[model samples]
Target: MAKNKNGSGFSRRKFLKGVGVGTGALSAGLLSPAETLSHAGGALAFGTPQGPGAVPITLHINGQAHRLSVEPRVTLLDALRMDLEITGAKRVCDRGTCGACSMLLDGKVIYGCSMLAIDAQGHEITTVEGLSHNGRPHPLMTAFVAHDGQQCGFCTPGFIVASKAFLDRTPHPTREQVNHGLGGNLCRCGTYHGIREAVLDVGNPTGKAKTGGQAHGAL
Candidate 1:
């Protein structure tokens, strides 16, 4: 509250009006939160309420940097699949309950749908598509195919990414450990048995990879 020429402070009604104006500006995209406010007549100054529209953001994913334009509300999953065309992270149960949208942020498992694209700026993002080597499939991916870990494919990508992160932490996991490690993801197809087996086989240095050729389809 500022004193006017008469040395009077702002009334409650005037303070509320200023707050409303600031809030409206944010939602309507007229001014970003980072934008500085200007003073006019010792009162809250509001710009023309035009939507902020899409803003440019850069994301580092899969050993590459991508520049794109998106609204602040866009989730990392939407930005990956819809904007950048990097669809390895599947979107299911977008509320972060199901791990279907799992991806790696700095080698740690995360739900892409639960994080904003604007907030994923600095992390090293790795989707399922990024798991493979130069020309060969990632060992975990190969293990999934060998064990028939995926069916219907909606949850495969998440499982693969999560499994990768889990194994990175627990390289030699028991069957029970593998089960607990993948507790966050779900497979409606009830392929938990094969999924756990895949993780176990990948963790086992002496276990032979199965002669399975079924491909993990696109996310």
Candidate 2:
């Protein structure tokens, strides 16, 4: 046989043979496409984004510590409602535009839907459910009920939570101040009058001592 110009004497037949062997090795070692995809999505494994996997963290809420494993992408609202079973914060807009998912973070009101659970670590989260104690409603809660601030009640939780933060800062807010402070929360029922009255009642001297009395009776 005549020698090829290249020192290795490579030929089409030899190249084809090498490809066949390499393909055979790959076929023997690799999984099917469906099987590979299934494995990739199976669990907390390699090649997965660390941010999407469940991570252990503590949430300080309502004067208590909650230990849980949650994905970093899980919103504070979802973590509270789904994982912790604290559904007081309603998922209304779920987009921060509506304050239905509002909660107190370190005493500052924030939209729970817009915040990541991982970012809330080490901060005190106060939800609507946390506002009550010993079977007694918070002053704001009492005022809401007394003033009939809620109709459908879907937005009541967020309103009440936001009111707490608002009242904490401006304890005796005027009608205008109350309007501006709680502007974030929206009520479809057009109960602005009642909501404003509810919050104002908490600070009014005439209504302070009578807290929960009229509200409970009315309820």
Which residues of candidate 2, in runs, are more than 4 Å off? 1-49, 207-219
Q: Which stretches of candidate 1 lie over 4 Å from their true place?
A: 1-52, 208-219
| C-alpha TM-scores of all predictions | 0.71, 0.71
Per-residue CA lDDT of model 2 for 27-55, tens digit only, reads 21133455434433233333644546565
For the record, the alpha-carbon RMSD of candidate 2 to the native fold, in angstroms, is 21.2
What lDDT does model 1 reach? Answer: 0.75
Model 2: what TM-score? 0.71
Clashes of 1: 1
